[model samples]
Each structure stands twice: as structure tokens, then as C-alpha cells.
Target: MTHTIRNLSTLVELRSNEVEKLQSEVAAKESLRERHQKTLDKLTHLYESSGASGRLPMALALNCGDYKQGVMAMAAHQKVNLSMHEADMAVSQRALTAAYVKREVLGQVLEKHQHAAVTAQRSQERKQHDELATQLWYRGHK
Candidate 1:
């Protein structure tokens, strides 16, 4: 019984540590998600402005000697912006999924811990009851 109690205590401590680690990871992911969102927003604004401005300046800046080269540079920049936007969306989605999974995992761990504690308490109570009953029977015999 003493060993069982000790093991339960150890398990509780381990679970607590795991929960803390998961919490930290979730926080870090959230921070990353926020940063990614900001980058995505900035990229969106840049893309909109570039479109409004006709993107000629960007093409000329790229040293595209011909109209074809200029157009290619503009196309490349647009493609890059689109790719970044997609990547940001993916990262945000993953972050959200991680958060949900972490919460669910934590909930399950807490529920398991509660059940273990309850079972231990009930077992201890039953042991005490049996001991008391045994003592009473012995006293009556005496």
C-alpha cells in the first residue's frame, strides 16, 4: 500500500510536469501564430499597393532591360507574396490545431488524475473501515 501511494504520487508529479510543458508549447505556438498573421497582413497591404501602382517601378528596379523581363520580375514578386500568404495560412491553421489538441490532451490528463485520486481515497477509506471492524470484533471477544 505504501509503495502504491508513492507510485501514484510520482505519477501525479510527472503528469503535472507534462502539463506545464504542453502549456508552454501552446503559448509559444500562439505567439508564432500572431507573428505570422502580422506578416501576412503586411504582405497583403504590399501586394494591394503594388497592384494599384501597376508594379512598373518594381519591374524597372529589377533591371529587366526589356518589357518581358520587367513583367517577369513583377510576376515573380507577386508569386512570392502569394506563396508567403499561403504559408502563413498553413502555419496559422497548424497553430490552431495544436492548441485544440493540447487542450484536449490536458483535459484527459486531468480527468485521469482526478479518477486516480478518488480511487486512492476510497481504497484508504475501505482499509480504515476494515481495521476498525476487526478491532471491534476482537474487543467483543475479549
Candidate 2:
């Protein structure tokens, strides 16, 4: 039983490690998403601030329009990419949570096994001590 419990504990530890790995992956994806979002925000701010200017050469204005269109396209692409990363992070988070729960349940089982073994040992010791005391009392009285 002890050997089996030890094996189970090892398995649970492996699962915990897997959960940690998944958590790290999720964090990395989140970081990537944040970076993409920041880039999109910067592009948006630039576009908005550009509109504040009142006058421009007609040729320059047409060029600026083209530049703004390009920036908008890039921002849209980044937004879509960020959303995909967010979805991946969510999936990893769910998997990590499930793994953690399984490991915790196994840990509780391992603890129970140890506790039961100790309780049995103590009960046996108490029985032996009671028997020995009773024998000594009878011998002394006789």
C-alpha cells in the first residue's frame, strides 16, 4: 500500500509540474497579447493626433490618407492576432486549473493513507501497552 501510494504521489507531482508549465505558457501568451494591444493603441493614437492638424498640401493630404489606411489595416490585423492569443490563453488556463484540481485530490488521498497508517500503529501500540499493564497488575497482586 505504501509503495502504491508513493507511486501515486509521484504521478500527482508530475501532473503538478505539467500545470505549472501550462500556467507559464498562458502567462507568455498574455504578455504577447498585451504587446500587440499596445502596438495597436499606439497606431490609433497616432491616427487620432494626425487628424488634429488643420491644414496640409493637397498632395501631402492624399499621401497621409494612404498612410492612415495602411496603419488601420495593420492595426486590424494585430487586433485579430491578439484575440487568437487570448483564446489560446483561456484554453491553457482551463487545462491548468483542471490539472491543479486533480493533483490536489491526489494529495488529499495520499495524506489520508499516511494518516490511517499512523492511526493503526498507535492503536496497536495502545493495545499492547494495556495488555502488558494488566499482566503486571495480576502478577503483582498474586
**What are the models' TM-scores?**
0.43, 0.87
Native-referenced Cα lDDT, model 2: 0.85
The number of clashing residue pairs in each candidate reads 0, 0
Best candidate, lDDT? 2
User: What lDDT score is found at residue 89 in candidate 2?
Assistant: 81
Cα lDDT for residue 132, candidate 1: 100
Clashing residue pairs, candidate 2? none
In order, what lDDT does every prediction score? 0.63, 0.85
lDDT (tens digit, per residue) of candidate 1 on 1-142: 4555566566556666665666666576667656656665665554455443345587664543454445555656666665676676566666656656665665566567667878989999999999999999999999
Question: Lowest-lDDT window of 10 residues in candidate 1?
Answer: 61-70
Cα lDDT tens digits, model 2, 1-142, are 6786788789889988988898888788888888988998998887777773237788888878878888888888888888888888888889989988988998888888888878988999999999999999999999
Runs in model 1 deviating more than 4 A are: 54-142
